[model samples]
Target: MSERVLMKGNEALAEAAISAGCKCFFGYPITPQTEISAYLSKRLPKVGGVFLQAESEIAAINMVYGCAGTGTRCMTSSSSPGISLKSEGLSYIAGADLPCVVINVQRGGPGLGGIQPSQADYWQATRALGHGDFHVIVLAPSTVQEMADLVTRAFDLADEYRMPVMLLADGLLGQMMEPVVFKKREENGKSFDKSWAANGHGGKRKHNIINSLYLEATELEEKIHERFKRYDEIKAKHTMAESYMTDDADVIIAAYGSTARLARTAAEKARSLGIKAGVFRPITLYPFPVNELREATKTAKRVLVCEMSMGQMVDDVRLALECKIPVDFFGRTGGIIPKPEEILEKLKGV
Candidate 1:
C-alpha cells in the first residue's frame, strides 16, 4: 500500500532516490538543499548505502562520477553556486556516458547569489552545463510530490540512457511541506546489469576502458552524433507538462518551478474575477513542452511568462511559439519571490 506522508521537497527527493535503489550519494552542503544531504546522511547508512559529504561541490560530483563508474546508482545535490562548481564533473560524466543523478535546488545566481528560489539556470541547464558538447536530462519539478516522483524517474532514465540526470527544483519547492503518496516499493527480482563495471574483474570479460577521449577526430564526432541521436529519442519520449484552464483561455501564463505554483494561484484568482487566465507548467525543462506551448498559443492571443529570474524561461516560451502571440514577461531576482496577487494584477492589465 502507498503511504501518505508530509514531506519537504528536498527530503522527498532523498527518500525517492533511496526507494529507487540508489546506493551512493555525494554532495556538498548548500542552503535550500542542505536537507537533502542531511536526510541521506542519516538514512542511507541504515539502508546499507553510502552518503559522503565531500569537501567541495567539485569533489562531491567527482565522487559521484567515481561511484557511477562502478555501475552503482549514485547522486549529488547543491544549489546554484555549488552546481556551478560541479559543472566540470558533470561534463566529464556526460562525456563518459556515466549514469548518475544531480539535484539543483536552484537559488538566485550569477556569483554567490542569495539562497532563494529562482529559475535563472534555464540556459545553463539546457545549453551545455560545462565546456563540452554534451547534454544532461533536466527535470523541473514544481510540487513536492513531483520532487519525489521525478527523482526516481531521473535515476531510471539516467541508467537507461547512460547519461547524467538533473532534478531542477527551486528554494520554494525545497522548503515547502506538502502531502504526498509515496510509491509502493516493488521487488522486480531483476538486478542491474553490471557487466561493464570496473569491479576488479577476474578475467570474466575483456578489459574495458571508460575514457572520454578519442584520438581520431572523426571517431569523436561520430560518438557525439550518436549521443545526440539518443538525446533526440529522449526528447521525444520525456516531454512532460501540465495545462490548467488553457483549453479556451484568452491569456496563458507560462512558468515553471516555484513561479508556476504562484501562477496557479494567480490564475485561479483571475478566473474568480471572470478573466480568462490559465497556466502552463513545464515539468521537463530541457526537452521543454514546446508542443504544448505551441498548442496553447494557437488559441490564445497573449501569454505572460513569469519567473524568479529576469527572463530566462521567457525566451523558451517565445521560441516555442515563434512570436506567433504577444509574450510579456514578469520576474524578480536576487532572492525576491513574486507574489500571486501581483501576478493577478498583471493579468488584469493584460
Candidate 2:
C-alpha cells in the first residue's frame, strides 16, 4: 500500500523531487513558491542532496544549467517574475537538450502584479517562455496530490527526453493542503538513458559536450529539424487530458490547473438544473490533448472556457475545435479566483 500523508502542495512538490532522485536544487526565493525552496533547503541536506540559495533568479537557473551538464538530477522553483528572469537559462537548457525540472508556482503578473493566485503566465509558458523556436513539456496539476504526482512525472519526462519540463501551477494549489498517497518510484514507466550524460567518467569514456551554439547556419538548421522530429513524436504519443460527464452534453467547460476545480463544480451545478454540461481538463499544456478534446466536445452545442487569466487558454481551445463550435471565455485576473457560483452563472448565459 502507498503511504498517505497530508501536505501543502509546495511542500509535497519538494518531497516529490527528493523521491524522484533529484539531488541538487538551485533557486532563489519568490512569493507563493518560497515554501518549495524553504522545505527543500532543510530536507535536501538531510538526504545528502545540495540546496543552494542563489543571489538572483538568473544566477540560480544558470547554476542549474551547469549542474545538469554534469548529469546530476537537478531542479529549480520560482514564481512569475523569477521565471521571467530565468528564461534565458531555460532557452539555453532547451537548446542544449539538458534534462531538468523547473517549477512555477504562479502568482498574478504582467509585471509584479500581485502575490495572489493567477494563471496570467499561460502565454509565457505555452507560447514564448524563451526567445527561440523551442517547447517544454508543460504539466498542469490541479490538486495537492496532483502537485506531488506531476513533479515525479516532470523529472521522468525531462530525463527521458533530455529537455526541461515545467510544472505550471498557481498559488492556490501551492498553498492548499490535502492527503496524497505518495506512490513508489517504481510506478514511473518512462525509461531513462544516461549514456550521453556528462558524468566525469574521464578516460574510460568519450567526453559529453553540452553546447547550444552552432556557428554554422546549416548545422543549426539540421539540429532544429531533428528536434522538431522528436517533438512530433511526442505530440502524437504523450497527449493527456481528463473528461468528466462530457457524454451527451449540450455545453462543455474547458479548463486546466486550479480553475478546473471550479469548472467541475459548475458543471455539476448545471447538471442539477437539467442542463447538459461537462468539463475537459488538459493535463499537458504543451503537446496538448487535441484529439481527446475534439472527440469529447464534438457533439456539444457550445464550449465555455474559464480561467484565472483573461482568456489565455481559451485561444488553444478555440484552435483545437477549429472554431467549429461556438467558444466563449469568462475569466478574472490580477489574483482574483472566480467562485463556482460565478462560473455557473456564466454557464447559464452561455
Candidate 3:
C-alpha cells in the first residue's frame, strides 16, 4: 500500500498523471490551477517526463495533439477561457481520434469572470467542448483522492476508446488540501492494447493514419455515423454515478463534483429533521447515469439540482426524470459555493 500524503487537489492531480505514465504535459497557467503546472515543472523532469509551458492555450493544446499523434501519453490543463482557446485543437484531436487527457480546474466564467471556485463550466465541459459531433468522456472528481484515482481511469478510458478524456474539477477541488493515498501503477494500469500506438512499426506493418478530414460528403457522413455508434456503446457501458440513501428518499439532491460534497452533508441534516433526503453524485457528466437517477428518484417527491452555475446540469436531471417529480434548482454563481445550511434550508422547503 502507498503511504498517505497530504496535498492540494491540483498537485495531487499532477502526481496522479505521473503515476499514469503521462510522459508529456503542455499547458498555460490559469487561476486556481496554476499550481498544477508549477508542480509539474519541478516534478516532470525528475521522472524523465516532458513539461512545456506553451505560449498560449492554443499552442498548448496543439502540442498535446503532436505528442498524442506519436502514441505518447500526454495531457493539458486550463481554466474556462483557456479551454475556449484550446477548443480548436480539442476538436481536431477528437476528429482525428487521438487519445489524451485534459483537466479543467474551472473558475467562474462567461469571460474571465473571477478567480474563485465555480462550476460554471459544466455546460462548456459536458455540452459544447468543441464544435463538432463528438464526445469527450467527462469525469467529475469531488475528492483529492478521486483527483488522483480518476486520472488513471481517464487515461485508461481515453486509450480504450481512442478519444480524449476530461477531468472536470472546480477551483475548490483544485486548491483545497486533503489527505489521500494513491494506488500502485500495477493496480491502476492501462487495459488498452497499445498495438495501435503510432510508434514506428518499421517495415513490418501497414502505415496507420490518424485523420478526421473526409472530402467526400458521403464519406464524412459515414464516419460521423460510425462515431455515433461508438458513442452509444460508451453511453451504455460507462455511465456512472453514486447514490446515497436514495432507497426511500423523499428529496433527492442531484449534484456533482465539489457541490455534491455539500449536498451530502445537507442530506444528512435533512435526514435529522425527519426528511428522507439523499444525494446523487454524477461521476461521469457526459455519459450521465440517467437510468440510475430515474430509478433512485422513483419514490422522490422532489429533486433539487444544485450547481455553482446558473442551472446548467438541472436541465439534464429534469430531462432524465422527465418531470415525473418536481425538479427544483438552487445555485450560487460567480465563484460562490452554497453553504450546507443554505442547501439544507432549500432541501427542507422543496
Candidate 4:
C-alpha cells in the first residue's frame, strides 16, 4: 500500500495529473485554483512535462486544443469566469474530437462574485459548458482523496471517448488539506492508438487532418449524429454514484461535489435522531447517474436535493425520480456552505 501523505487538494490534483501521463498543462492563474498552476509550474518540469501560464484563459484552452491534436496528454485549469472565457475553445476541442482534461475549481459566480466556495457552476459543467450538441464527461469529487483519484479517471475517459473531460471541484475542496494515498502509477506508455492524430505522418502514410469545420450542412449534421451515438454509449456505461445507508430510508438527500460531504454528515445526524434518512451522491454530474439515483431513492418517501447553488441539480433529481416521490430543495447560494445541522433540519421536515 502507498503511504498516505498530507496535502492540499489542489496540489494533490496536480501530482495526480502528472501520474496520469499528462505531459502538457496550459492555464491561467485564478483564485482558489492558483495553487494548482503554482504546483504544476515547479513539478511538471521536474517530470519532463511542459507547463505554460498563458496570458489569458482563452489562450490557455486553445493551447490545450493544439496539444491535444498532436495526441499529447494535456490539460488546463481555471475558476468559474475563466472557464466561461474558455468556452469557445472548449467547443472547438469537442468539435474536433480531441482528448484533453479540464479543471474548474469554482468560486462564487455570475460576474466576479466573491472568492468563496461555490457550486454554482454545476449547470455550466453538466449542461452548456460549450455551445452546440456536445457534452463533456463531468466528474464531481467530494473528498480531497477523490480530488486526486479523479484526475487519472478524467484523463483515461477523455482518451477513451476522444473528447474533453472536466473535473468539477469547488473552492473548499481546492483549499482543504487532507491525508490522501495516491495509487501506484500504472505505466501504460503510449497506450492509446492515435492514428487519427495530426502529428506528422511518415512518408508511408497519408497526412491526418484534425478539424472541426464541415462546410456542407449535410456533412455537419451527419458528424453531430455520430457524436451523439458516442454520447449514448457513454451515458449507458459511465454513470457513477454513491449510496449511503439508503436501503430502507424514508428520506433521501441528493447532492454532489463538496456539498455531498455535508449531506452525508446530515444523514448520519438524521439517523441518530431516529429519522430514516440516507444520502445519494452522484459522482458523475454529466451522465447524472439516473439509474443509480432511482435505485437509491426506491424506498424514499421524500427526496431533498441540496446544493451551494440556487436549486440547479434539484431539477435533475426530480426528473430522474419521475416525480413519483415528492422532491424538495434546500440551498445556500453565493458561497454560503450549508451546515450539516441545517441539512438535518431539512431532512427532518421532509
For lDDT, the strongest prediction is 4
The 10-residue segment of model 3 with minimum total lDDT is: 187-196
- TM-score-based ranking, best first? 4, 2, 3, 1
Instruction: State the RMSD for candidate 1.
Output: 1.5
Which stretch of 10 consecutive residues in model 4 shows the poorest summed lDDT? 184-193
lDDT of 4 by residue, 202-270 (tens): 887999888999999999999999999988999999999999999999999999988999998999988
Off by over 4 Å in 3: none
The whole-model lDDT of each prediction reads 0.89, 0.92, 0.91, 0.93
What is the per-residue lDDT of model 2 for residues 41-106, given as tens digits with 9 covering 90 to 100? 999999999999999999999999999988789999999999999999999999999999999999
Misplaced by over 4 Å in model 1 are 188-194
Clashes of each: 0, 0, 0, 0
Question: What is candidate 1's TM-score against the reference?
Answer: 0.96
TM-score of each candidate structure, all chains considered together: 0.96, 0.98, 0.97, 0.98
lDDT score at residue 290, model 2, on the 0-100 scale: 93
Ranking by lDDT: 4, 2, 3, 1
RMSD for each model, in Å, please? 1.5, 1.3, 1.3, 1.1
| Backbone clashes, candidate 2 | 0
Off by over 4 Å in 2: 187-191
